[model samples]
Target chain A: MKSTEILNSLQVSLTIKRLCHQLIENHHNFSKSVLIGLQPNGIFLANRLKSNLEISIQDEVQTGSLDITFFRDDFRRKEKPLIPSVTNIDFSIENKKVILVDDVFFTGRTVRSALDAIMTFGRPLSVEFLTLIERRFVQNIPIKADYIGKSIDTIKEEKVSVLWKETNGKDQILLYSPT
Target chain B: MKELSTSHLLGIKDLTKNDIQIIFSTADSFKEVINRPIKKVPTLRDVTIANLFFENSTRTKLSFELAQKRLSADIINFSASSSSLNKGETLVDTANNILSMKVDMLIMRHPHSGAASFLANKTKTVIINAGDGTHEHPTQALLDTFSIREKLGSIKEKKVVLIGDIKHSRVALSNIFALQKLGAEVMVCGPTTLIPKYMSELGVKISHNIEKALKWCDVANMLRIQLERQQIQYFPSLREYTHQFQLNKTLLDKVDKPITILHPGPINRGVEITSEIADSEHSIILNQVENGVAVRMAIIYLLAGSINRV
Candidate 1:
């Protein structure tokens, strides 16, 4: 296999700081908006963003984790059962602006499933997507990120991976292709 | 990334300690989901599950169905009385017909021991044993232990007693395996005939006297007397059984420390336990029922995760 690093730790950190500033420009108070990290992969990114955003605004931001394991369209297609991650949304989402965060944006299916999963809590006044890396091509669903750290163009065979300091002990984005 | 060694939940004996921990932790997450304003999740949206109850069930059937629905799986209910089983259709044929309709998973409660395991070998669909005859009610054991862990904070080193009919209870057998596996001390308390002769071989302590069992236990799981399974007279009369074995507030009050009371219900209120004790603060019977849904969800979610893996 062949791999390429797109962003190192310093670049990733600077991108997150920029994202936090941009978030404050749009959501100054965040009184009506809540941040939801899609489960398993998105949780670390969501936590980092929540921490950064809170420090920048000097105000607490409500955050929770949502696992869409049951809501996926491909669940029946796979032979192995998908182990579910914990969903810890103690607060209601009714009429609130919801920020859905994830490490990478690919086919947009995950975001679509996250949308369906979030409605169960309550109807959101608006929904926004945030991603550390966005693959500009290969979206099966018509979805785009409102807050993107970096957008990269890639072929269908190439995979975009985001490694977080919380999980991988380093912050980096890599693109890989079969040799 | 660790998965259950077995594909189907046939019995408690098939589960290892690690399997139970994974299940309990998964159930813990689901327990949180059910308490939310919107109790439903969408993880099983594309999966279809059929609840096939060859035995009559209120709690097991309803709880399993609720768990399936909350996971967003399409559900179909098949009770033996309402189906072609009454018309003499074989279990295999009935199950095959359901699978023919593209059912992904089967949650079964059957009257014969090992029925779920037997059917599991014959089908490609994942099978979960809700309960099986006088053999093993794996889910009941799971929910019971789950409820116990929720109330007491853990199942390790807890003193638990299974009281009433032990010979004919699938619940007792499964609980013995589960509780013991989780590091709890288990004891069987009942009459000689009702308590099996070979139960001692299963590493369970035996107590014939109800009062002694109650005093020794931190949790007393009062099982319903299976009158239907008794072909011959095990005891002289219901009066005699109640007089000797019935758990009431008076008996419970006499214990030095408060002991938790559990009963797998369709409870014969005045027989195994009085209404006062069943309704008391010491009872976790209803909590057991509530936890049943969460535990079943966890099991289904886990099993479904690996159903069609490449």
Candidate 2:
């Protein structure tokens, strides 16, 4: 595998800080705006954003974890049963400005599925999306993101990995292409 | 990454520990889905299911129907009493007629053992055994075990006793297979005549004493006497049976440690278990019913996950 480092540890931290300030600038105090992390990867970014918001805004911020396994269009189309992560959204999203966060944006199908899955809890006033790495020119579905840290163009065979300190030893984003 | 080992869910014996875990984890997700305000999903939107009931059922039938509807699958219900089975049509003929209508899957409940297996052999569609006579009620067993795990966390190293008529119960048979496979120590306590002779070979403890069984178990899964399936009297009378084996509050209170209680429903009140015990916090009977829908959804979802549309 030929890997290209998209963002290193220090670069990743700076990008997250920028994203946190961007969120604070738009939704001041985050009283009406709720941050929701997509399950598995997005929660890590969501939590970091939440903690950063709490530190800067000097108040608690509400964030929830959402899983979209059941709402996926490829339910019966898969070779094996799709495993699901935990979905724990206790507070109602009704009329709240929902900021959906994810690790990387590739096909945009996950965003579409997340949009549908969030509707089950309550009707949000509006849904905005944020992602760490937004791959360019590879979207299979039409989805627009409100916040993006970095964007890149890659071949279909290449895979993008956003490693977190929780699972990985350090934080970094890399694109792996076939040699 | 785990898939069901077999295409058709004929019996618990046909499933491996990995398969059971797969179903349980899938059911865990469905549990979250059902708890939400909008409980339905569009996973099986394109598939059609035929619920064929060759026997009488209220709980199992409704549970399966609710599960299919939650997954957004189309269904056509058939009760054998109202169908052409009364007009001398065979079971195969009835199933074939349904399958010929382009039914994508079949959920069946029949009065004969191996009816689900027979249908699986004859049909190309996936068959989920919703209680075949004296054989297996795989989903019920799954939900029962699921309730135990939900209430008590894990089934491993736990003492689970199945209390009731074992000879005529498909639920008991399926539960035995499921509980044993999950590493729980199983004990079947009932009348000697009601206990099957082959249970000893299965390695579960057999006890004729319900009180002693209660003391020995961490979980008590009380089963109904199944009076309808009882062709001959296993015990002298209902009074005698109740006297010997009824799980009332007194029997429950006698246990030194906290014990989880489970009953697969259509529960015979005051017979196998008293109303007090059934309504107590220790009992997860209603949880078993609610989990029935979620667990069946998981079973159907996993079984139908890989089917290629024709």
Candidate 3:
């Protein structure tokens, strides 16, 4: 199977900037809110959003990265389960609204596991989901994104990989089918 | 699907049969790597690992650092004395700062129990607890098992005697769990105060007489007695304990069967074990130290795989 070229001429940085503006406008009154990025690419996107949010709010917004490897439901199947990256949230999350940011949303298992991992720290007033891309598929749980940059229809065999210059040396989304 | 990658190695008691097998098999692969001339691999190449040592250590810290280096991973050593953590910088802040550098794993040895787990919660790095107060030293136990398996073939139904300061030794606590899981009959012998009464409930027999325990065991593991832990006066005198509990050549004669001697160093020399027994042909004490690197390399390789995939 050949991978489809859905993002052949896409401008990811522009889309991300526009998404940051939308998120800031949506929660302009939040004072102590934080942005928690899920591991790997989500963390990269979250850090980028955090810098942009900090400039717009003119205040220091707490930014953290979370790794959900141990909390995953399918951990038993991975041959070489990578050690999770660092999850760093220095401040308290109790009674404060949080935006759970990620690069892409698929079956929502990662998000579900992220919630389980987050609850171990403290209870939050509410958690809003934000993603750069959302796949058109049935989620295991009734979870929806509060802010989405783009929505793409994909099949089970298809994969959406997000590459950025900060880590991957490029900014593009690839739709690949395993050969 | 590897079960070892998904769970925190906080204690050996929680390990299943499969978990033990995975560690053993992984260590076997690492042993081969140790024998190679190059003695290095790209398994963890480009990954960042941090060593958070809140307590001063020579053996454990160096073994872990060497293990990470041999696996081709970048390592950052954080000594508590020099770290901002000494100036009341919170553990969270230290972790956050290291996280910003994108560390893939954190190997920690703190003076408090559950300190590694606390750091695990704060960071995405896989936490390998080196030693937390007197709580547990999982890697030491794992390497001991590796040493035993190399010598004895199998630990199933083997009589393993653990002699020394049972109450204050983290190595003793971790060995009990590892040995029991591998099907060894573990017995701990020491002064009355040092040997907890309810230890049999943890599947270990407590004996005050080393002579009795020696007669019935295939393997004898001796633990170092920390002078600091004696402030509470657990024993009447160190001299008395040494005379009765120390495993010298004369004590080795009590065992009729072929016996192996093990210890987590630096040995007390004349306290828990004598120079004769420590350097004896039956001693695997040095083997335990050599195996520590291989065992730690296995851990870092398995855990760092997650980060490289990113």
- Number of the top-ranking candidate, with lDDT as the measure: 2
Ranking by DockQ: 2, 1, 3
Across B1-310, the per-residue lDDT of candidate 2 in tens digits comes to 4767889899999899999998999899899999999999888898999999989999999999999999999999999889898899988888888888988899999999999999898877899999999999999999999999999899998999999999988999999999999999999999999999999999999999988998999999998888898888788999999999999878776876778999998888999999988998899989999999999999998888767733
Residue A54 C-alpha lDDT in model 1? 86
lDDT of 2 by residue, A28-135 (tens): 989899999999899999998998889999998999999999888887666667887889898989999999999999999999999999999989999999999998
TM-score winner: 2
lDDT of 3 by residue, A1-179 (tens): 67665553246777778888887787784586788999877988888888877887787778887666545665324555544455566677887888999998999988987886666557888888899989977577778988888899877778898887876777778888868
**Taking the tens digit of each residue's C-alpha lDDT, what string does model 1 give over A1-179?**
69899999999889989988888888887898889999888988889888998887788899999988666777646655556788988788999999999988989999999998888788899999999889897899999899999999998899878888877889888889888
Per-candidate count of clashing residue pairs (backbone under 3 Å): 18, 0, 8
lDDT tens digits, residues B107-205, model 1? 999989999999999888899998899999999999999999988999999999999999999999999999999999999999999999889999999
Candidate 2: segments with Cα more than 4 A from true spot: none
User: Could you tell me which 10 consecutive residues in candidate 3 chain A have the lowest summed lDDT?
Assistant: A75-84
Q: Model 2, chain A: how large is the TM-score?
A: 0.98
State how far residue B217 of model 3 sits from its true place (Å): 0.7
Measured against the true structure, the TM-scores of the candidates, in listed sequence, are 0.91, 0.98, 0.64
Q: List model 3 lDDT by residue over B1-310, tens digit each.
A: 4546345666676677677777777677566556544466555666788899998899999999999887778999999988787578888788878878888778889888778778777766678899988888889999998899999998899999888888888888889989988889999998888887668789788788999999988999989887775668877888988888989888777665678999888888988888988898899998998899988887776655554353
